[model samples]
Target: MHYVCLTTSDPFLSLRQVRIYREKATGQVYAIKKLKKLEMLLRGQVEHVKAERNLLAMVDNNCIDKLYCLFKDEEYLYLITEYLPGGDMMTLLIRKDTLTEDEASFYIGETVLAIKSIHKHNYIHRYIDVILII
Candidate 1:
């Protein structure tokens, strides 16, 4: 396995930033989900993170974010994933009252398909509440 030394001072992460990171070679942008404060982590949340990773690995679709890799520090777990150029759907919804019928249908269709795939694999997306922007 490949590894690199990362310091707390490294710009890759910050206190308030829930996600941060850069590609090692190509400088491609990526998001880092820091699972430090999650109660499960504090109480040994190994199962939750492992389950999430397992589920993410099984997902193969363009509409869903791709989990690239996982890392760990002494106290936290880091989930590296693809950065969506189009941000979250909730953010978009907050900025607009309603989308055109066709646009709404397309987005809903894609989301439903993605959800169906996840359920088919026996994984419930608990984080979907925060990603309801579509």
Candidate 2:
């Protein structure tokens, strides 16, 4: 539970802001997603948040990010997940503009596998943004 924040700003686009942290106990790194409770209530995303937690718990695959834990304060709900040091796909695409055929195929294959796994769990991903891919 002892973790140190590694960033002062959000690293990606989403309904919540993500901050990187490193656990002092094991020196393991993770991403902490901080979602404002007020925003969720206003957007009627309360159920979505719960569903996300449930779905994430059920998912177990290398292609999909894994959630490690969840916690909440009075203002924000936090989701702790395994950290991927490699930046998101959007950042990669922005820097490289395009990928070679092999690289593109690899990414596409991973995405397909992730999608199939999610479907198997009876959850359809509503967001397919590059930022969602790590």
TM per prediction: 0.72, 0.87
Which candidate has the top score in lDDT?
2
Candidate 1 colliding pairs: 89-133, 90-133
Query: How close to the true structure is residue 125 of candidate 2, measured as C-alpha lDDT?
Result: 64
Off by over 4 Å in 2: 8-14, 129-134
CA lDDT of each candidate? 0.63, 0.78
Which pairs, if any, clash in model 2?
none
Highest TM-score: which candidate?
A: 2
lDDT string for model 1 (1-134, tens) is 33333322222224213454555676677666666645554566567667777877788766666788887777677777765555556666768778889878888887888888788889885665223432
lDDT of 2 by residue, 1-134 (tens): 69898974455445699888999999998888899999899889998888788877888877566888999999999988877666667777888898999889988887888788888999886864222344
Stretches off by above 4 angstroms in model 1 are 1-17, 42-46, 129-134
Tell me how far the alpha carbon of residue 110 in candidate 1 is from the true structure, in angstroms, after superposition. 0.9
Each prediction's total of clashing residue pairs, residues at least 3 apart in sequence or on different chains, is 2, 0
